[model samples]
Target: MLRHLIARFVFLLAAICAPVLATPAMAATDVSTPWTDEDFASLRLISAQTQTGSSDTLRLGLEFELQPEWKIYWRSAGDAGFPPQLDWTGSQNVGDANILWPAPHRFSIFGLETFGYKNHVILPIDVAIPDRTQSVAINLDVDYLVCSDICIPAAATFALDIPANGNPDTSTSGASTVSTHAHEIEKFVSKVPLTGDNLPIQVSNVFATKDGDATQLHLSVDGLSNAGVTVDDILVESPLRIGFGAPVAVNKDGESNNRHFTVPVFGLNADQDLASETVTVTVIAGPLAIEQSRTVANGPTDASAQGEPLGADTMAPATGAGANIWLIGLFALFGGLILNVMPCVLPVLSIKVMSAINARDGEISRVRSGFLASAAGIITSFWLIAAVLIAIKLAGGSIGWGIQFQQPLFLTVMTIILALFALNMWGLFEINGSDNLGTAANDVINQQEKGGRHLSSHFMTGMFATLLATPCSAPFLGTAVGFALAGSSFDIIWIFTLLGVGLATPYLAIALQPRLAHALPKPGRWMSVVKAVLGLALVGTAIWLLSILAVQIGLGGAIAVGVGLVLGAVFVWARKRSQNLRPRFVFTALAVTGFLVALFAPGFSKPPAPSSVSTAATGPLDWQTFAPETIPALIADGKTVFVDVTAEWCVSCQVNKKLVLETAELAEFFANDDIILMQADWTRPDPEIADYLASYGRYGIPFNAVFGPNAPKGVLLSELLSRDAVLDAIKDARSTAGLASN
Candidate 1:
């Protein structure tokens, strides 16, 4: 979201630094200039072929490699520093050298967000050759700000020559091409977002809105459908020098390929005229990058009062309230209620079931109290999450539901806790109050203390349930969370509270009617078997998290954690089975050591690689990657398309797959030569899938839709899908624009 709209703003003074101490020389390869060394950086001109043989233009690259901690700024350079300035005045036979900057990574240091490239970066520049038969002598003078703990301005000059006439060598793809720095230059060139009409991503609409002292940019964009890749952040390059913060997706539904965003405009007063201005909008979502020039228009003012994000005004309550807020609150409640039934929530559901069964023969007072404690736990945990999110928002950090799953540390801790729960469930270890003091009277005291301990555990159970429920987005939950995330702090706090209440509603209901617990089977020998079965469920959940860990870090880190947990489980089993105290002590020591590995491994491990690679669609159902833009064309051609937006962590999605889509009837229907099945996997966080789900105003997964001639837009399916619903929708989709032909 770093756009250098710096016409009026004063640029940071780039202090000239001392000469580059020492560095290894880089080979020129004839087509490229040797590394022009600087204090903390090296610059070079690189090209695949020096000759412009059979080519109209000479493709070249200006590459920079910085010291370990130094970085060069992007176009806008963020809150501090300036982008590199290149002067090609001394060049010969070069019409105009246009340097294309690749997308930059955002870095926040001491509360200031900056955009730049660290380590190595290449700015691909295409030097237009006016005369094809003339030799081009390219001379470049570059000045840039490179920063680490401090900012330093460095200058360097580089030169390269492209000879006139020689038959261009054919590349591996059998095309006349430049092949010197071909792969390296092409990679950097690809990083440069597509512009003009070539952009797959299209900005449908853009407008500016102002409220009080705050100005905002509202945008509508289309063309985002990439598997596992998240296309979220939007940057604005305005001709009027208007600065825009990173835009967040507005949870509101739109057309299939389109999504909306709201950006906070910096250094713009409410009095400034914003309409009719031209700006280049760059949307970066992992590998899917595109930019478009848009004419600004006026947009609808906020129905409610707004304030600057991360400002004191934001900390206060919003003055005006809208009816939609209430509706969102209701949705939040319903979403939370739905979460209890989500397949991913089974781990905690099992705990609640056990609590109910144990209470079946217990005192009514204890039953009510235990359930209330659980309810309280859920409510308290939700508030805690809200508080944290509020803080993050205030700090201008990216915030979202279920986003914590993306963190390796969070995944590691969760795996360890769940693994221990599984071990305890399997009777490997029994949690009791006394490690010692085995006196008869102390035993009586322990018995007396059991009730209170059970209640506390019930609360913990509710908290754990809330944590597990995050990965499953129920229908209303996504809308409510999205609404809150985009709204004032009050909205965030209030909506999340409603969601907590909604999720705890069932628990509250059971508490109100203690007789319900009495209806369940009383405790018996059968309970132990149930616990063991539930233990397997937790183990499965842990394994799923580990797989995500593998994706986050590397396979090696994930294996380290997995092995630790498995060994810990084994040690627990031994400790319980062994009769000797000495053997028990040894088992305990070994178990702690094993569990510690899971605990500390992620913190010590290196971070995951800079990029994530998502593979092409592969499945038995002939499921292609979900591309909503392609749907209209296929439907135009009389083909029926079924789009399934699902995530790996979504258990309900798996259930729907087993019961509906993957069923023989639907399978055969989708396998039809005319039928196209597209699946958007939300196994990893994906902005496109999220936006697609939001378009229908449905947030939670297990989302499916069918499109055809009759249902050109799409026919939505139930959240908890059924086989009949799937077939009926497909049938409806296939129903004729003219007449039913299938």
Candidate 2:
């Protein structure tokens, strides 16, 4: 488990690079400007109109013709520059002025992430003017950073005169030109999609579920080409939801739209849903777009016109009496049995299988004790996990397995444990290392420890092994866990506990039968060799721990962790060297302390905060933080956005990033085109990312989506990534939105 965490950390470090460069031109429409030599310039705001239900919504534009090669910063001016700011405090009869920015380019100047636009750009503003006011005067105060090799700050205080007259000949050619430009930008914005409606994806319904006591959003989408889509493509926004990889393709019902996409509700991974009201969906299908705001009413409430229920058939027996009780128990048992084979427990099992052969001669009572101990271990571990998961779920946390690693303290604990095991295996210290006796004495010690009749140790070992195995859940296990989280609290707890029992049953059966134990080879010197091998396995586990350290502290820290392991070995050696127990105890304590401090040192360092305003090619982008409330606004604006849900430990995510996302080609494409890129990192198992993943019916990494015009909200992408795949997916999504390459 530690090894996987380290790999994920390394992947994230290698994956994230300088921000992708966006060409400001992508966001701006009909960008033209009047410019003079040197650094001076002016931007003009024009009027455009679009009809709503009753009145028309006013669209204003800021057109700037910067000197060639000169640039202006976006809302998030990246590194050292300031973004353009506007003050409409003095405007008359204008209810609101919302600046619409085009996506901005990313520049790594002196190792800084800068967002800006070059040449000419137009910033369109949405204004809600009073219907009574024929024309409203526009006044503005603006500040911006312009760069041409070197950067310079500038501001403009300007006003436009308007006669309190009729809606100023909007049909004229001049007005039409501005309207065209505004509409062009709207093309990009319109892609943020909505929920509901029968799409090519065919969202049959969206439902609220309690999976293992965790709140989840379930979206049933039909028409899957294959079951692989269940393990890929689908993505959810909220981090607090729970999901498997993707919606599992149930055996097709043979209907054209029988494929269902089960996405966990956003912010529902908690024991209780954290949502105040409403659910927003940005459905992106190759270029087809739909963005809608659906109210998240009562728990799994009847489907509204805006959001559909997952499926009426999906409702399990509301009355528990006649439920498929046998099947539920079978699922639990199978889930537990499968967990034993998961990556997290593999090594532990290896040790146990090897150890079990020797314990065959033990007495029935002893064997029983060992089995009970193992059962206890398994139960305890599962309970602990359940408790934490439930706590977080109740708290509205959005995260899944290995979430403990997010805390430096947890990483520190694992580091110390692994180091000790490694040192013991490497022979730096021996368990009862010193016994000034002949070879025969060691054999006697081994026999005594095994206790011919005591089977409890072996059983206990099994349980302990199972407990340690929780980190890496297998595929089916994730599904089971997700199901457990969605159910009632008691049911969640019982299901997990039952899973533990099922996992231990096989071993217990063998322990209970003396005939099974009597069939083993007689104990001898070979036993020492076997112990030595077990020691080696322990060392391997330590190395895995060190790998995780490398990610948190870099390669240098890994070496430090290695040193701590060595120190632990020395302590073990010292304990063996002398009969005095006090010195040994002190050395052991010191070794443990050193390992912990080294593991968490990197977390202490702080990083800069991300800015809200982002400059894109559309003009000036008014960046909005991701939230349940922001969906309505994003849909209304109609901008194509690219959302990345990443983690520090997700290796696949890094591969996709370095191999595809960081390229200049992608950067150029996103910038020149009015696309918004939003990144949500789960470097430390963030609740937010968890919520986001759950929304898509997943509990781990490598989640992605694209929001395009006409389909402006979002479209989930595949889990295993390829640059070409993403590009094609985006292109296809764009095409669905009535957009075609010219």
Candidate 3:
């Protein structure tokens, strides 16, 4: 912000005083300084007049010509980056100086937008000269940022001396020869936008549609009626999560040359809704641009951070934060059911099968109760997770699915619990209803062993299944979760509960029809073999978690934790069969002590292991590191970009890579030079990547999108990608011009 620059200018003087980049371009004129020689861009100072003469004002410009695909920010750089600042502290005979910013073009990539200038631009300035009779010396110290693939901070010193007016300066130039930048100065000076009433654009009317289920802005502009404007032709800037989307013409009046555009409001939350703040709106039409500001009328609203996909068709229609909960609920249910087959859920399925087998010999009523308890547990677990997410959302923190796996402490805890479960299945130690520690839950429900199994045991199984299911986003899960997370707390609860119910559908059906339990084969010696196999599956899960823990706290910590679990299992096995005096006390203490390393060894400070995406691995195709800001400029140059947002921890992402993205056919197609491939690694916590995901209303991985000259908003793929889906999306993105809807 300009205010930030002003507040910290004094502290930043040392850095600002550093010399500019050497090797400048040849001086354009005696009134102009040489351009700084930088690979990405070059800058110079140009004066329109060689002498101050009788004129009270001296005109100059800071001219910059950027290399291909490079850009600099406007006065208000959207999303990220800052504008250039000039310090004239070492100047003589200058009373004041003012910078006039040229109109900036909006860069649209993925779902976010930024404003800047590409190619060449000049920022015109006017100086107030109190004494035109005296020689005026101008020294400009400029600090600015330029970005292409990376952002580089640049500084330059430019000096231009204006000769004193003796004969009132002959024609304001010596020997009737004007400065070389005279024409360029006039060209950019005309490009500066007019302010206030001088601006051609007018906000004819501003109104908000606030209802129980909706909060939106309906704007009517006087000059742009039926001007054929798309969402790309406008830019919105606000310091809040919720914002107005691109203007869509709802009604047009050719007779009056007016357009009533309905703007979809996105990401509105409980705290900030753009209600009391000013929103800067910029409209771009060919070479003409105009900016205006309108303060939203404050009102009571139920808007939450959730918003429908922006630039959908025309209206981008949506109602309130809880829009289309019924559809979202159904999607969640189906997504949850599909989680039953995910790779991460395989171990839990074994545990589930063992429990089912043990209950097969029990009475039908007892079997039904156990299944019902498990189903209840799944729903209760979802509620617990939803509660935490809601709390984080309310407190303004980042929240995402499977994000818990990013924590070392959580990984350590999961590893120990899985190991213990494996030992129990291996018969290292037997747990009775008296031995159960579910006291808090036992009070509400009878946990006493009825038919050799307690309800608490079954309930815990369901809860664990839900936890494991999070790593791989099941089919339809991303949509349902994105919708849920983007909306109110109620939406999250509703969707997640439906997801739990969907996942527990099989259990619920068995509970409803107790006869299913009676139909299982009678318990036999084969059950023991099945238990061993199930135990192995759980042990494998523990191992996988250990590998991830190794990345978090180093291999040594993981080995120590693994050793502790093994020793703990050894003591547990001995406690069951040992004949020594005080064997129970000794074995129990030893087992508990073995598990202690896991509690204190893992550290959360270390980042997760780098994934293929993070490393930007060399493949058949030329893959670029994810840089969202550069996407639009690439598209402007008529190139297609395919972006894959993935993480190593995401099973679905690996599946997509093997089955769709890395396939021979798609690989060959992407290998084409025109097709730009960018991969983002989300293995570690990255605020930029998180914000990008949130922009699209997604909270999970295996995300894919295609951007091209035709598709400005890009084509969003599903969590699970298919060959046909990938081809169709890429083709559509490349061939179709401005396909606004997914």
TM-score of each: 0.52, 0.45, 0.56
Candidate 1 lDDT over 492-534, as tens digits, reads: 8999899999999988999999999999986889999999888
Give per-model CA RMSD. Answer: 16.5, 22.1, 20.5
Ranking of predictions according to lDDT: 3, 1, 2
Off by over 4 Å in 2: 1-333, 395-399, 423-468, 502-534, 550-562, 577-681, 701-742
TM-score of 1: 0.52
Point out the higher-scoring one by lDDT: 1 or 3: 3
- C-alpha lDDT values of all predictions: 0.69, 0.51, 0.70
lDDT of 2 at 271: 40
User: What tens digits encode model 2's per-residue C-alpha lDDT throughout 357-392?
Assistant: 655666666655655556665665567567666654
Question: Alpha carbon lDDT of residue 373, candidate 1?
Answer: 89
RMSD of 1: 16.5
Which candidate number maximizes TM-score? 3
Give per-residue CA lDDT, model 3, range 373-396, as digits (tens): 889878887887787777655544
Greater lDDT among 1 and 2 belongs to: 1
